[model samples]
Target: MHTTQTFRHVSYLWDEAKALELAGNEVDLFIYRSNLLGADLRLTNYAGGNTSVKITETDPLTGQPVEVMWVKGSGGDIGTLTKAGCANLYVDRLKALKNRYRGLEFEDEMVELFNHCLFDPKCAAPSIDTPLHGLLPYKHIDHLHPDALIAIAASKDGETIMKEIWGDQLAWIPWQRPGFDLGLQLEKAVTDNPNLRGIILGGHGLFTWGSTSYESYINTLEVIEQASEYLNANYGKKRAVFGGQKLENTDAETRKARAAELIPTLRGLASSYRRMLGHFTDDARVLEFVNSNDLDKLAPLGTSCPDHFLRTKIRPLVLEPADTLILKSAEELKTYLVEQFEAYRADYAAYYERCKHDNSPAMRDPNPVVILWPQVGMFTFSKDKQTARVASEFYINAINVMKGAEAVSEYVGLPEQEAFDIEYWLLEEAKLQRMPKPKSLSGRIAFVTGGTGGIGKAICEVLLQNGACVVAADRDRLDDVQTELRRQYGKDSTITAAIDVTSTDVIAESLKQSALQFGGVDIVVNCAGLSISKPLADHTEKDWDILQDVLVKGQFLVTQKAVEILRKQKLDGDIVNIASKNALFAGPNNVGYGTAKAAQLHMSRLLAAELGPEKIRVNTVNPDAVLRGSKIWESGWAEGRAKAYGIAMEDLPAHYAKRTLLNEEILPEDIAKAVLVFVDGSLGKSTGNVLNVDGGVAVAFVR
Candidate 1:
């Protein structure tokens, strides 16, 4: 148990006459008031903190007869105070006292006498920690138990815990009572370690001071953030718990056997009270906890912590063997609601009456949390995502904590009324109001092969912009691609892999690496391919094999591996193949290349039909004359093809452009954007469809 003390003192009684007298006598008081007013407006929770400044004065003309030292005034809750709450004391006098006693104990009476001796009788009482502030030689000091810092301090091993998380960038102090003794200890510690940056009082708060007030405050927040991360890593409560009972294999079989007996009642409750009970199905935890040694003895403790109240409620509904029917669960929920909310309603009415200057909705619903049944365990109820998420996180944390606490002692929580007050507090309610709506594909992942190539890179960029984290695979080194991506976006936005898509072994390794890197894959864009423009007579058997390996065989291997991952993870996936417009409209040269590309298109359509029942979408993009700078551009094939067609090298783009009805030069980026449409589910209700991004070239061929 800890003893709490309160300090209350009259610093300066505000009277117009005394104010006028002080205004005339000391110009410093006016300056201090102006500074205090400025700081108060910018800070949100200043009441929980303190600030101090050192003062130095000099002659305006001739620099002579100056007083210089640190002065700290009364400490009080800053939220409910005005400028007059602060005290002004002579810095030199406090320093002289410190020099005399060296390690003297400072009592409240001593602080009071010191303040009285420094200024006129009308001045405010010096703060209880005035002597402590006076002992520090720094120019500015600020202290606060900011919420971020409190979250860290409240954890076990918060000192070593914080140091490991934040490194040696911050200074830490063991917990101590706040007063002259604490001040003396700090002074000794600071003296021993001259390079101290800040002090973290374990299980208490933080302290930071700098050359300026703003710097001190910012530094305090920076240190607190370090502590918060440390706590979050080691002691973060679970976001939700498995509320249903644990089941043995035998018990699971028994539940299935008895399902025929319970199905009718379960179905009725689900149909009639879907809004209240959510979707409930018999799962393993439900069966195990139901068949546990004695659920009645353990279920009352509810979740492990306060956050659980938002989810699992304060307690779970327990059903005994004799009362396994859904009607019994419904009746129990009704009785609990009537008993709990009657008192809750009365208190809410009183609270509203007392604080009714502003008007909002009465409340979304008084019943945000619920327990389902004993055998079924707990279930949360919320009308919106915010309530649901909050409840989920709470229930998760609570369940873990409850289990841990139960091992040591009975699981206990704050009073029900206290929990209600926090749960319904206006400030907390505002937090729910500010939550962003969830995206449709929030948890989905994707992969893009040949990601370093022009078309592949384009697909990857577009996919990332929409929300999916893409794994970009290429045979080249991943360093340049990853660096470029980080420069364009930032680190970890897209992952990179060095892989030869044609090798079955390499494709398998790449998919494994991608899954480990990006959680899982929901989309695969097989953009990797090769082309060689050669007359049929000049084409070699090896050239055909190369084209087949890259264009057809490579895609087969990549898709085969991707499908295995998608099936194992039970993810609905999409595979978009990048075929060429030449596959649809044959040309005089490039026989092998055209044949392989055509085969790839037909294979994609077949895969689409095969994988459709499994909810995996497969499609292909046919693009023509996308002459962007890439591996093909570096090969000098465009110039050779132009010469073979009796056209100038510079005229090659226009020659191809004229073949399209639109006569537009297609770009790799255009094809990439089209690929994005299929990958993002924008081409709704259409898979196995080969969308052409070829500037109307296919239409010209048909005409």
Candidate 2:
């Protein structure tokens, strides 16, 4: 028997002093309040909630006091909402839109009018839910998607239960796609009730407000706390969840390993147009739901909350029952996935056709955004790590809501027609259109060896600039590289790990890191190497062995390990090996280094031929005399090569440049660009090739 769990209250984080500090201005207090409310994932998922404060500001043109409203803007998260992120609009102009509103059918037009109401023309764009805050009569208002309140709102007996908990303290409204009509409905409810503190939108979320920011903030917390009390009192004691657990969870490590093995394939299929990054989570709550007998039934019902649906899609595709999943072979799982993908796409298209309006933007991506494997975990894929992570969190929110709702009354998703209406809404289409275009390598993940070294670091930088999630794997100096990349690109775009390419075990760990951090790897760059130049008679046994180990063997092992992830994706992948111009030029006193480079060059060609059927292209960038930002040069290669030429150490760069047909200095950035060419989708048909970034070394050129 499951014991009743204690009611955990939403943290009351309100500090009176903090509010008082910002009380002089409504906008400041509103931003403050929004930050507090948005800080808790329990309060609202990323960008799911909106906050507004109707304030008095001086008109820039008229120099007179004007009533303005600031609401969290379209696609802005309240947790990080700044003044720049809030849409500032004239109140009179917003109310003026009411005259233009034809009916619920034409509510989308209201969004266009909101821009005209902007107090500043460059202010943030307003969302469709703007009127839900603007047209309201309160000075401060919040539209939040608290899981507890959404649980009640999504339940079969939601409104009835609300009446029981707060009686006349809160009002109820049936589910309505947020627009002018719903805002008016809200306005009327508050106008008529006169005694209600908040309103719960059926199968949607919650609405709370007060005369001041503090009051509104407190009201939101109080209402959620009250809902928690009621739900916890009834949840475990009332009935079994998701028809109760039907499968034992695989251990956490096993679940993660399975996800790592599986997501690459799913990710490739999902990336029909643009590749997606993945985030995996095995929150106990999610595992419970995944292990439950009702997973198949409930996951397909999708999420009731619009925000949840927007992140998680209308429904999740459950792969198999937890207990019997391991019994199936990997090939069986893969075959099943392909069939399901085709079926899901067709089904999504049908959904769009059934619900699309004549003016609806053409159907969006039909691939599933959320996938569930019984007893394994929930996996979400998006264009970047942060978005993927947020989606996963939102689905977990959906799970919590479902658990509480099923504990009392059956949990119900938004009606299919209603769900379609919200999904294909023109207002949302505009939001999607307004987003900045993706970079060249958006959603692609790359693992860079020696990522802290000069050439490796340059490659990582270029890849990150092009929007690839980079795992900068190096045996040393990872902390500095990770901090620099995080500072430059934010936490979502890059991660660094300490790894040795020579060890298969270490290489496997790097790929696992990539899988967990940003889905799977699509691009692999072999740049970890050292150079040893000496007369054949002077080269020691240790010198030859070390060069081969680090240069030839390391590159081989790195590519060998990453090929597993690439193969799993069942998609196109790129491996660029950094050999050297010396591989072909036969420079004097370079036996140890030249031999390793020659071996690397041929190995790349062999891998290219072997992996061609899998769409894994192998290529090489042979950089000659790359002295600028080179660790090999810093150690001894520059002096050794200079000695071979009977020239000063400082004279080697100019000597190499003068020797090339183009007489150009080959920088690390130049070599980095070469690595990019092989994977940037430009040379799709070209592979088993060598690009000499030697500034035109005629002697090193391939025949």
Candidate 3:
């Protein structure tokens, strides 16, 4: 239930919107308000809702008044919307499409008409629902899928309830598949009720309009409040409690741990892509819903609206004997999940055949996007974490909405046929088909050591950009690394852990947790290292022990544990260890660093030989003097190098950059590139090899 305080904490920046309005940028003010509506997860999620504004401008070329509709671009999320996020279209052209769209049903011709209506050829594709806004007369229009309103909209007695509250403030439009026809129907309703402030689409969502963005936004908020207050007062008693206890006795740590154990198995089963990531939630409300007796009955009723079908599927998959899954071995759990996946596929195919019609598109990938298990709570999977996170939030709200609706009356969803239509709607399907293909390393997961350092961070960034989920592990500064990565990629694409490379127990646990959380690891970059440059005769025993612990022993522990998980997944994997150039060409006063790296290099060869039968490739990347962004070089280590070479400290960088035949300044990105070459199998046939990232250093060249 939404408390008053909770609703008060909206993300809307009212002051910013006012400033924009005062500056004569009313379109920007509307965009800002739309972003606020999108940012509030309680109001809408992902790209669920859209907003638009009608502006009058004098055409310079024609010297005539022109009205333009700036609507949200297709596939653009309102949460991150901007001026460019909207598609500009000539209003007259869009309104004229009605004549061309003479058919009763929307088809390729309607799609072509929408494309031709674009004012700018290079503008983003307009939303499928652009016609809905185009036909409306208001200057500002807002559309949202708020859970509170959805609960009321999806109920059988919803229309009666609305009449009892607000008699004719909102015009009622019965359900119709959204397209040219639906927009015309809405326009007729508006004509029929000229005084109406908003329109409620049965089993769909609400549309509010006004002369200003603020008025439209507030109108939507008031409706949500009415729905929320009604549910809390009349349907409060129906709230489900987890395990029949007021609260679960376990703490947060315990819940996540237990959930993590089941994640890998769930991911392996629910995976539709080659590699799918899991976003687990042990949230109190989520746990309560999953553990409640009503879950099986209420959950599969379908989403509150048709728009959600693309991400959450029609329903969430329920796993039984959840208690047994907790105690089962990885292999046993995996086998059971595989069986469940097959059964699910068969069931989905049957449903498709039963509900599909002539205009229906082909069956989409039949895989469960959300899965519910008792002891483990819920796990949502998508192509990436951002998608999964949104799905998780949506389902959580669905549970709340269903509970409220069930209390009001027997909760009923749209019929199976309606669901099939929306899920495979031509407009949505065409947009998806038009999207570019995934990157080369899409759906792959990688675990990198020393992720807070330069080389490690570079590896994480490049991998994320190329479409891999990264688990960045470090001894310290893990939180900082996590924040930076999330900012760069997204919250779901990168996860971080505090791992002491010297501690076997810590390394083992980190690897296991990462594999479970991120599906499984396919590439492991063993890059954690620290070098102590000193004369061999003067180096203390303690210095040598620390070097060996991190470079040689630490590399072995991480790879050994990660490899075990990868092999169990039965997928070919790669292990690329970061060695130093001194490993191949030991320079003066570099004994401790050189010896440890040499050991790491040889160990890679041995591991390659041992794991070759399993198709696990192991290799080494030996980088030299990558000082531009290296923490090791920044910590006065370059001064030591300068002393050893008998040169000025200020001249060290140039000396190293120009020392190589190529005279290029080696960087962390350069080392990361070499690492990927081996991991991506550009050298697919070769293993037990050392690739150098130095700028053609003749002395450091391998024989």
Worst lDDT window (10 residues) for model 2?
Answer: 1-10
lDDT of each residue in 550-619, candidate 3, tens digit only: 9999999999888777765666778999998888886888888899999999999999999989888999
> Taking the tens digit of each residue's C-alpha lDDT, what string does model 2 give over 327-375?
6788887787889899999999989888888888898889888888888
Question: Which parts of model 2 are misplaced by more than 4 Å?
Answer: 1-8, 14-23, 646-664
**How would you encode candidate 1's per-residue C-alpha lDDT over 584-618 as one tens digit per residue?**
87776779988998899899989999999888899
Q: How high is the lDDT of residue 126 in model 3? A: 82
Task: Sort the candidates on TM-score, descending order.
Answer: 2, 3, 1
Q: Kindly report which residue pairs in candidate 3 clash with one another.
A: none
Best-performing candidate as measured by TM-score: 2
Alpha-carbon lDDT of model 1: 0.57
